[model samples]
Target: MDSKTGAAGGAKSGPRVRFAPSPTGYLHVGGARTALFNWFFARHEGGTMILRIEDTDAERNKPELVEGILEGLRWLGIEWDEGPYHQSERTELYRAAAQKCLDNGSAYLCYCAAERYAGGDHAEEEGAGGKVRRVVRCACRDGKPTSAEGQPGVRFKVPLGGTTRFQDAVFGAREFSNEEIEDFVLLRSPRGEETAGQPTYQLAAVVDDIAMRITHVIRGADHISNTPKQVLLYGALGAEPPVFAHLPLILGADRTRLSKRHGATSVTSYRDEGFLPEAFRNFLALLGWSAGGDQEFLRTSELIGKFSLEHVLRTNGVFDRAKLEWFNTQYLQKLPIEELLPEVEAELKRSKLWKEEWASGAGHEWFAKTVDLLRPRVRLLPDFSSWSRAFFSDEFSYNEAAREKFWKKEPRLPEFLGQLAGALEALAEWNHDACEHALRGVAEAAGVKAGVLINATRVAIVGEAVAPPLFESMLALGRERVTGRLRAALPAVQESCKA
Candidate 1:
């Protein structure tokens, strides 16, 4: 969909953006995608991207989780150009903005009990005359700020009669009525064991956006409802609102909003499960956005060059995990051997499948060749270790299904393996063509088709029915292991791997 019908549009140049996430948990996929979009917009326009931590909720904020979130962004190659400005550290900014609202009569003091608005931010309550409203405003309209002892929380005032409207880049023109809007809490006064008052999310976010001079706000569509409130806050502070582009929500394959039942939602979960960062970034970029055409694969450089809010999808993106795996598979096959090497190495090391021999020299040559042969067959980084575990170690199990299919079908497997192993051991120079010649000769002597030996040899060599080409696989696994595994799989020689 190339429709840019109502795009509020891009900044002139050097637009500032921010990816503000609260440090409550790991950076989920949706949050990661938002960060990616903001990052793409910033990089596309050569602008500054600020990382802001909205950690004002002291009781729920985990200091340890902040680093995890940062790590996730870094892992996705979403490096910020500015400080991961913590909202808690910037209370002066929010407090000052709240006071300006109070001084200007845009805000008021609520002498009501703290329990009056107990549900916290975005919580609605019944107003006068049994009417329901999004917030509880002070009856007297006493404009003031939070105090330490006789603490009465502050709230921004909503205009009695008017509608707040702003243009969205993806979803088009949107409006929220002032009468329907809530005079939500601006600063919550601390009680029991506490120090300073905390600015509500609306105040802190608006204040920071204004202070940071952010020109564009590219975030998830879930925050669309919060925008009108923030717009009011910006107007109260006499600041211009940024260009808002609320990205469509990412849903699961079932078309439901993404959640745990849909699969692992965190970015690190994919990272830990062997996803390539470039591939993952490429996949994340396509969710709720497009560079156009049948081209699914986009490099980071390509994405930065092509990314525009005009192409941002109005429809919610479906998080097709199978499609993501397909993307990972393509990268595994197409990326340079050098680029895939370290990732495979790291994966192998993690799985305890790595060898000291793969470090350098002739052994390194063998390792490199093995990766080349295995790369096409690999889907994930762990596949480098799991799919081809036999390449790294002496001990690896044959697939049960492979054993039943290939081994059970060939009654002469022991004789055939013994014959093939003998033929292989007698090779002068070991390579694909030479190994092929040996196998064919063995099959001819056994008076059976090469397919029989090929099947047995495959399961014996790699312990998997499907693998890289048999001859090349023999070369990568080297002359010794191939012949050894074949001989070992023989019932007479060793019943350990007998079908």
Candidate 2:
């Protein structure tokens, strides 16, 4: 399985890479990172990036999973120049390769039963030092080639001795001794039927890569062990092997493999949780590769300009949620108001937090204003639901603690409200600046700090002390709702002051 002489040949005219994800489940974060790297490499070099769905495992593959992979890529803005070709559709190609290997004597039939192997014993045997080796010896290698009840089960004959070596773009040169790997099965069957037998991933992947003319194979480091087998397959088929680069694994904060226990692992989960695609892409790109210095955020084009296989680190990376959120905030703050408005509306509607009257009759300018007010404060879509609740509902639910602490206990509350209402009613302009000046005057007359009066007014009108800028919130709420909530809160304020 030695790497061919021309393997390290200079860069091809047009680099070609493929993101071949098995449609086994949702598009996981690890898979998304691989896709992003491939896409960046192809785009940077003005080459082609292909989307190939490895769906040969019928029992594991799902149609919805295929849709999920496409949706995830589209969400990340990772477009492919070539296919989303399905491996199942190309069975004829795999069959031809298997037949060629068989005809060339590179592969043969093995029908050994599971019990015939040396390690097949169920009972444990103790050695002289109480040590036992769970060794599995091949029955076919011993000249007693068993057949699968007269049905053929294909097996590749691995050449003995020597070593298989390849220079990995990220991990550098690596050599795997041939003695460590056993000659594995190429095709198998559940039943003793010809139609049931089919080629496994090892053979299918090699055939597909050759057929697709993939110039570079970029994938996770976990597949490093599978590379030699693939290289051997390429040699057996008389095909050239693609350049390989295995990315480091993404680990949890605990330095373990990422899983559901760590956090959201799938791309759709992040999208639903209000993560921006650009931010997600930026974060994934930096996981195993760095752009140097303290720079964290980069646009897709900027990422392409800086990306290279040599920059990718061989060490595993921890998927830090805080860093991801920080990146999301950067992208969120830069979002154009026009583009953010629809997302805000959609999130509100999806969460059933939007009022039909306000959303439909108020028009886009009003919505834009609301989004502008909330944009700087919002980190995620769900934040808008709670933060902007006062904007949607007419009746405000004043926090009991705030009412007791600020509004209810303040002396001369009625006089302050009466004076403030009179000043607001007499004003020609009811905008934020005018409202602020008028309320500040009332606070001065009452011998209280502006914030004190402002806090009370905020609770009276919006039902919460923590809200948008007090004056801006009041103007957006309109005069009717503002006066109504304040008037309703007056009696409660007066009663508490007396008590």
Candidate 3:
């Protein structure tokens, strides 16, 4: 669609959309969701996706946060095909656009005090059976002395009548009366003419969208009210408004807007917490969108091919923390072991479980097997270190609750496992079958259930009562380390037995 005509044209080129994020804070889920949608739309249509930093508000701008936003986008595998244009550097373009609106009589200079508002000392008339309504609420909106005084701010001259109608891609037709729309500011007044204050979002957005020829405006539904006002600015600036597709807001379990209380809203925080990039993207893509069918696990290419504004839910997307983990688990289980090995290795490094030998050579196969064995039960990459830490290093923490449960169940639990460890050490071949046979033989002779010995030995091996299959876990822990940890726990278990 062409920006000037707002018409669907031939196959000259595809949509030019942009994710213009304000670097006021870290890139959170809401911003990342918008970027993901924009990327999906662009890639699906074989068009360009531009990254624009809307950093005009210098007072709130954190230059450090800009890199964070970029990093989050790249981490999500959402790459742009064009420039990461900064609004800070485009102040001249905004100034010129505002000047053009003023010259064309579509905007006016307001010399009102710093406290000027949309409804305060402006025009008001009684409308429809004793209702006082505000219309064109700016003092200099009409033919007043258009002074560049009061460090005058420029305000758009909204039509006093008629309705501003636009077809929203998701919500369909939406109309707002011109009288109900406020005479919004284009640019804030400057302390002096030499330094013009930054353009308001109302003006800068329309100006930048026009300048960049953005054919689509895909953003959160929170900007719905701002659309009508921006639509007026687009008309006043003699540019057609882009096709607007407002996404539903992401909500918590209680249906309120997602925040810190909703848990870890930062995109990079999810990365730090070991959410796979593809899994994260899949989770975000499904937040407000549906690719049909009952299948929720869609690949990036699948998401791109299936994404459309038609399927975007008008209702808010609920961020289910458990559902996100489910997606991560699915990826963990199905992704290639080689692909998962590095992620597991990085996580081990973070937890100080990394060893150079485990990355390659003789130890590499064992590391890969350990990862593959544990991946089925993991929901995130960090679990490789946290849940199965003993597989990589012996300095793993034993859960006191689990330890006490097993040690106290049978005071002689250590005796049972010690004998089982010695039986395993005497094995002709050290493997899963031999270990299991040895452990069962010791349990049977001692008149104890094999499960008792299994649970107790698991705590001794992995420092936790729960893990992947016992024989598999023991195999990954290897024959020597398994026997060594079991024997090493004897003194601690002996102390617990007396207690």
Candidate 4:
């Protein structure tokens, strides 16, 4: 079977990986990278990719964030094969698994109330591997069943000796001694507001993974601490746990964890800022994994073909915003004009610069040519509306800095532009060659360098000191608008020159 369709082919098909996210906030970039990695692995191995929502904590989980998570995943083009199953919906499944652990002597009930330990002075104790840990051991471990029904929390019965070890697909063999793991809570019994029994994350995650037949657990390395406990839970259920792969953490340029201070953490934020989805995916792929060569820019299909857990680096990946912008620029140049026009048009409309006449015929052709001319100059989608605004609307203002530098340099600027505009207007053909000939002739008549006339004209027409090439820009702007802009800027040029 072909790799693309290999997941469903034979009896022994492929791995089943999952991208489980909590609905506490919008899907951040780190979470998006995790989702992408899982998707890459699933597609590479011809396996299923599932989307699970770990929303057990209803109090902290915002309902609106569920949409954001799904939307972000869709925006990244990471499609899931299985459900967006909610842990909230499967409470009974977790409860049944907890009961099985109790019956098989793998778990016990703790009657110790949290209030008793509140004021107690408990020193930090050394756990397995000689690491310091805050351990809260229950007093009910003397093999006594609680008489009070459903009033105590259920804790897992960790083995007394030996270590729990699992082979991580990315980081290799990882071992955690049982002593390091406290008898963590599984099911919390009825309390003040939470009258109904609820399954803790440790319990719910393990149970769901087992039920869903997840063949590989691919997530961030921050969850490495919880893997051993999960491994024990999988053993208690008399089931084999899936392969674990802990991804490296995504850090900022300061080498710290990625956060709001790092800028544009959310996938939706990048989309709003005019980052192409393809470029964003490529950027995420390079964060922790690479193709093992010097190829920096990769398409999505190439990524799927080259993706492997072995290439993923164990070192933390830095979230470089500047690198992301560079990737955006590359993608802007690669995509066809027709494909990018819709987004550019949308941005124009959003900025109130779009005209109804630009949808078809000559006006449409002009807009397409303008986009082609400005494509290389743009780094983001919003740049089209901001940097290329003069192409779309006549209401654009001169950048103050550009005005001070170009127009304010001399009063002769308006006369030079006037001569050039007159020459350009009188041309039979208003193309790039005609525009350049007219401007060069005017410069020769004024006894000034060609660059002086060209730079001044650029500032006059585009309201900026920098843009696409002068003649090309004017060619796209057309003769009528170009002459009108020169006449309009003549007053500002005279005023700034006097100042």
Local accuracy of candidate 4 as per-residue lDDT tens digits, 372-434: 889998998988888688988787889889888877655688888888778988999878787
Backbone clashes, candidate 4: 0
**Which pairs of residues clash in candidate 3, taking residues 3 or more apart in a chain or in different chains?**
none
- 1 versus 2: better lDDT goes to: 1
What would the per-residue lDDT of candidate 1 be over residues 108-178, giving only the tens digit for each residue?
76655445644433456567878876553445354232222366667778887789999888888899887
Off by over 4 Å in 3: 1-12, 117-135, 145-149, 192-197, 261-263
Q: Could you tell me every candidate's TM-score relative to the true structure?
A: 0.89, 0.87, 0.91, 0.91
Cα miss at 146, model 2 (Å)? 4.1
Looking at model 2, report the run of 10 residues with the lowest lDDT sum.
1-10
Candidate numbers sorted by TM-score from highest down = 3, 4, 1, 2
Predictions ranked by lDDT, top down? 4, 3, 1, 2
Score residue 70 of candidate 4 by CA lDDT. 90
lDDT of 3 by residue, 16-129 (tens): 898999985678899999999999999888877888888888764667879888889888989987667777777877888889889999888877745454334455678788
User: Which pairs of residues clash in candidate 4, taking residues 3 or more apart in a chain or in different chains?
Assistant: none
TM-score attained by model 2: 0.87
TM-score winner between candidates 1 and 4: 4
lDDT of each: 0.82, 0.79, 0.83, 0.84
lDDT of 3 at 3: 40
